[model samples]
Target chain A: MSAITFIDYAGVAVFAATGALAASRKQLDIVGFIFLAAVTGIGGGTFRDLILGVPVFWVANRDYVLICTVVALVVFFGAHRVESRYKLLLWLDAIGLAVFAVIGAAKGMAITGSPAVSIIMGMLTACFGGILRDLLAGEPSVLLRPEIYVTAAIIGAGIYTGCELLHLPGPVSYLSGVFAAFAVRGGA
Target chain B: MSAITFIDYAGVAVFAATGALAASRKQLDIVGFIFLAAVTGIGGGTFRDLILGVPVFWVANRDYVLICTVVALVVFFGAHRVESRYKLLLWLDAIGLAVFAVIGAAKGMAITGSPAVSIIMGMLTACFGGILRDLLAGEPSVLLRPEIYVTAAIIGAGIYTGCELLHLPGPVSYLSGVFAAFAVRGGA
Candidate 1:
């Protein structure tokens, strides 16, 4: 549970950067940047929560919004530097993808009361926000292209589900899921 | 119910024009125009159905997609003419808004078993497709502005709910709701 919380927090921050970058590409002002960041950060979780009729995760946890805001600020200040070293942000995005995928999968299981829905929910949580960001930025979402994105989420979710079948500790399953997602997302 | 059906069909057509306009604004390719039109036309209903656990309406009834596609083609060909008389599109939008509000409210009343949620659902169906289009097109969503939109939906929904309580015919309630919404939106 502790590991999940920590990783989820980190994941939100990483995803927030990717979203800000999308807005930056369009040269949006601060308000637009924040809006894009908020949408990107919360998009997947909001969709998942709404689908499950659960209270929205960010609304339940203001820290998530704060994280997004902070990340956007960092991106705003560091846009040129970040763009120069895009790899740093890309790696962070991979980590975010993996961690978020696990959180989404686990939450999906807890909320939707079905394993299949949980897995799909996990994938949606990691992928859809990025997809939405791209779509809104007037670019095709990477998910729609043949890419490692949705596949990474599915693999991560599969690992977590398998760990559950083996009666592993929740922390172990969560880490494994994150690791699985990152492994694929890192182009490995 | 029958009245709601007709209103819904009209709403779809109006939304198709709005989507077509978005494509024109972007100078999109034909495929892009169709994609944008399809997304804008059905996006809100898709969100509603996904959350409500209902079958996606257009997927179930291909006619919905057909309607939007045919309308989009018409708009694509007629965009210059439509732009020449922009007020016509705005009026069409108002009519679409009213019809969608009622259809959404009616569906919510039948599906969720809650009135407050139904009112919100009504506004979302009426307004959010346009919001999605704006967001996707990098324009400001009308929903975020100080408009009389949600207020109109609330008033119209109250009429529909009142009729539901008195066991009035659905068509009578639908027309009343539509009329109330149209007057408010147009007057505003």
Candidate 2:
């Protein structure tokens, strides 16, 4: 597989695992876990599409929903024995946030032709899934806290936008943005 | 008390009660119930405004949040029987749907310029909250259902818009719309 394809698939797995773990905390059944997984996976993209007045990406392609469902099921049932026991769930979630945040910014810049909106899209994509997760989990939103999650995503998105503006290769732009977000999040 | 005001307040109460009940089912604490209550109460309105390219209603004025919280408290601790029961809650929810459906229609018709958009706004206001509640509560969305819920909101909204075009008194227009919805829902 090409490097881009490999990275994209890896991002999907990370996001699915993060969503599945959150649902597992709720003790939600397979159906519930799958529901949340799909929402957390595509919700940011859908919101981005809606705001941009584009056809929803998932509705246009059934594969997005199917991939989310299958990945969720794999993580929910098969990972149960050591899922909650995994001490690195937060670390995995942070990686997902970093990668998804950059992807969101990249997609935003591709669509809106504005860096400002691109940053907003990145934060929305990176943080909104977790926002929905926390909201449904009935916990205080991490965004509401003084935590650097949104701030980190915003900065990462800015970096991505800046890199693209400077004509850097796509892979380099993506990695730098992800690392920027990951550093802040992992530190805080 | 004005019948309209009484009915609107009752709708708010019903929505708050349902939110609290749903939160309790998740074993959420008092704060969680209050937060979820406000989300359920004003969530639809906020969503409507967001999609309309307007500022979120509650983020500007805090009154809506306060009312939802207070109503949630009353529902959670004030009425022990209500907190424990099922059937009464269903009736309350249905009434909430009927009243709010009309109110949503009226507000949407007044704010948005087009009749079609207004009808859509009304349905969004009436149905989105419940959809969010169910989605958050591990229940499938009514939007995903073929039920008459959105259909009822749209029809009632059309009635309210028709009355607006006829230059009827605002209250009368509102009342007629409300009653029409109540009758249909009650019959169902």
* Cα RMSD to the true fold for all candidates: 7.9, 9.8
Reported per model, the fraction of native interface contacts reproduced equals 0.03, 0.00
Error of 1 at B42 (Å): 9.6
Q: What lDDT tens digits, residue by residue, belong to model 1 across residues B1-188?
A: 46557778888888877787778778887776777777778887887666555777998889889988887788778787654434665677678778777888888789866665566567667776877877877765554442565566666776776677678988898888889988998898
- Residue pairs whose backbone atoms clash in candidate 1: none
Candidate 2 lDDT, tens digit per residue, B19-97?
7777767777788789777777887777666655566766876666777888878766755565454555556666777
CAPRI verdict (incorrect, acceptable, medium, high) for model 1: incorrect
Report the C-alpha displacement of residue A104, candidate 2, in angstroms. 1.2
Q: After superposition, how far is residue A91 of candidate 1 from its true place, in Å?
A: 1.6
For model 1, the stretches where C-alpha displacement exceeds 4 angstroms are A83-85, A144-146, B1-128, B134-188
Error of 2 at B176 (Å): 33
TM-score of each: 0.58, 0.56
- In candidate 2, stretches whose alpha carbon ends up further than 4 angstroms from where it belongs are A1-6, A83-86, A144-146, B1-86, B91-128, B131-188
lDDT (Cα, 0-100) at A163 in candidate 2 = 94
lDDT (tens digit, per residue) of candidate 2 on A1-188: 78755565566567666677766776666655665676667667768767777665654345666677787888777766774533455777678788878888888899887988988988888887777766654556768863788888888888989998999999999999999989988888
Tens-place lDDT per residue, model 1, A1-188, is: 47668788888888888888776776765645665676678788878787777766764356887888888888888887654544665676688788878888899887665778878888988887888677665666777664888899999987887787678999899989988899999974
Candidates in order have lDDT scores of 0.76, 0.72
